[model samples]
Target: MYYIAHRLFAAHDRALGALIARQLAKKAGPESVFLPFCDTDEEDLVAPVKGHRLFELDRERLQTLTGMIAVLHGPSLDDGVCMEIGYAAALNVPVVVVTTDFQTYSADEHSPHWAFPDPLIETIAHRVTRVDRLGAPQLADSPDRFTAFAARNQAQIETAAAMSVEAILELAANNCPAPAPARAEAGTVFLEPSPHIRCPEALLDTLHAAHRSVTIAIRHQAPDPFTAAHADWTTALRAEVLVADVSGPETPPGGAVLIGAAAALRRRIAAHLPTAVITHAHGREPNWRNLMIQYAVGTRVCDAHSLARWLAS
Candidate 1:
């Protein structure tokens, strides 16, 4: 039997979680069940009252579950959700993270408001899926507009839920093999573009003229940037240069815990890939945290013009 684990905390989360569960349950075969964390009725509200019983029940469910799906949004990771993910990982349950917020780092006035997930959460999940919001008329404008908005939101949620179910099933089948090492040719450069950089086309042309094979890896807010970096670092068959854009400092949602968590993730990545970050002096000055990152990673601080010249050289 395949048991799927899920967490739903807030009122809206519970409503959405119930919708996902219902959809999964509808598609479930005789051998599969989508078990949500709220399925239990042991309500203590206060800690250490019925906490032991609650823990025991949750632990059993997690231990017996086939896989876990976590919904991560908002400013910080929920303590209970984190515990569930940790428990699932400890028991060798494959985990998938579904995130709703994604923000691009850029000074462009026309850019969309994308909220990146906590980097710590990004690092843990086996797979990360992004659920983008729908583009509909304002809910407060008219009846038709409100109806359209509601319908679009529902459709997007259902689509995300379906994708999660498919991922769980795929993991159970175990048909996917580990990704093979990327074969790097001589003079190959992996360019990671961010919204903060100006005119990457010219830079690309310069590298091309120098007989360098350039591969652009666009950064998605869902997956851990460090995870991708580590994979490329360890598994690339040939030597290649990673050119990462050091755009600006992150503005995490207001809270010390979140700020500290984001900082820790940045430091960890910098330590892992010290040479990947490329500083553009024309952009915002590397904030104190970013400076620490550059220093720790041992990345050379250079302007765009200098970087282009160096790449050509």
Candidate 2:
């Protein structure tokens, strides 16, 4: 099966998604192409899905996918699509990233990093397809023009989908990366906590007892500049173990990305490096945590004590 990750929060996005899905299904089979907007449970249509449940549902579908074709649209890559790409890559599942946007938005052309579509994401992907001049057809003047514009530009949309589908089929046929050699245990434990953690020192003090070689990267200490942020993420992926604290009512966006990347790395390498996701004891409800992080890490919430125990064991 193939999963198409794209933005569907807008009317144009939904219409384009349907068009792409239809074309992909024609070539890959109706049952093979899974578009989140079209294939979701019926109840999701009637009401808003609880955050955790949505994450759980997507991750479950991801596990069964043979390859993923992620639409990297807009000036910046969508955070959720990045998570899906990272997660799928970690599982050694082949990924093909398709972007119709031709405008350049790089920090520096000479630099090894891309300011858009994200360098790490591109690095992990098996194939990157750029359909020049066939940019998104949904950039109509108004919302009402979306349908008419799509209808008029059907040829361009089909061309883009056809190119993406070609890449997906080719990659799926022969591009699965082999898992790294398994290790008994990972060397270092990397901790990513939200800036909102209460009594941070006490929490670290407790965890330090179980593991001495722990690296902590919180939002404040790590500069938000792209280069520094990229460096921190690269360092985190090198560690054999990852522990992310996602306590509180919502998962901090930055912390959630790190959790997703680390979890994918752990899975890609098999049982070599394990990832642990912990939340504050106060917010132990399953819905409090992002389902992608929870299911990908595959662990129960670890308070300081339990986290330390997990680190030691």
Candidate 3:
């Protein structure tokens, strides 16, 4: 079976995503294709399930999936879809990213290459099927318009889905080995230090107190130091375990990308590289807007004391 990961918040996402999944199922078999939002009841808005529960459900499904067809739509890549790609890639499952975004955004401002979303995502994909959506009309709130939008993009959707199916099959047929594990000291943890992190010294001190070796992988922002940030992100991905302070006044650019990488690393269940996210508990909830981060890591601690306790256990 294959998992279909896409943004589900909007009418356009739902309409286009359903069309793609239906078309994909015709080629891959009806039983071979799964869309979490459509197939599962756990995400129902009425009496909604916890984010982690949904994460667990999806992770379980993904573990058994032969490949993943991820819809990489919009100007910015969807955080949740990116996490799924990382997780699937870590498991050595072939992933095909299908995008219809026509806007131009560069991975590096200084470089000549122009692209939407991040290379941290696209670089790892087995294949990226990019369809042109310039002719499709904007989605309206009405159901008829939504249908019209899907109809107009039917050829593009079918083409992308067909390419994705072929890519998945081609990649799955190859027997490529997973990269060798990084040479990390036992009990070593990679710390993704962010400017949004509070009491960074205390986090370091906590690691030192536990007698665990640490590697600080910093993701630089702005003026887009793409190469440097990518190197550090790879460092974080290869570490034994990852610990990041996701406490947010606001999510820094590229912050979610680091978390997504860590999420992927954590899915290496055989390697046991657990990832921890540290965020302040606001009233009862963590003070973060992004549920993708919570879904990615699942372990969120409020302070160094809590972190130390977690590490100790």
Index of the highest-lDDT prediction: 3
lDDT of each: 0.47, 0.60, 0.62
Tens digits of per-residue lDDT for model 1 on 176-223? 443433344567665544433353565567657767676654333324
lDDT of 3 at 280: 41
Candidate whose TM-score is highest: 3
Please provide, for model 3 over 1-313, each residue's C-alpha lDDT reduced to its tens digit, 9 standing for 90 to 100. 8888887667778776787678778876889888876776534533234554556677778777688888876665566676677667656678888887776566355653434445456556778888766345645553686676666677677677677777776776683765643343457677755543443577789888988777765433434445555666566666666676544343332445556555655521111112334444222234244455566664566667877777776
Worst 10 residues of 2 by lDDT: 267-276
Candidate numbers sorted by lDDT from highest down: 3, 2, 1
Task: Write one digit per residue (lDDT tens) for candidate 2, span 1-313.
Answer: 8898876556777676677778788888989888885687423444344445566667778877788887777554554666677667656688887777666443445544342433445555678777656335554465577665655466566677788888888888886465752232356666666545543564568657754566776423433335555555666667676665655444443454555666655532111112334333222243323345455564544455555555555
Model 1 residue 160 distance off true place after TM-score fit, in angstroms = 0.9
| TM-score leaderboard ranking | 3, 2, 1
Q: Whose lDDT is higher: candidate 2's or candidate 3's?
A: 3
Worst 10 residues of 1 by lDDT: 251-260
Whole-model lDDT, model 1: 0.47
The TM-scores, one per candidate, come to 0.48, 0.63, 0.70
The candidate with the higher lDDT, 1 or 3, is: 3
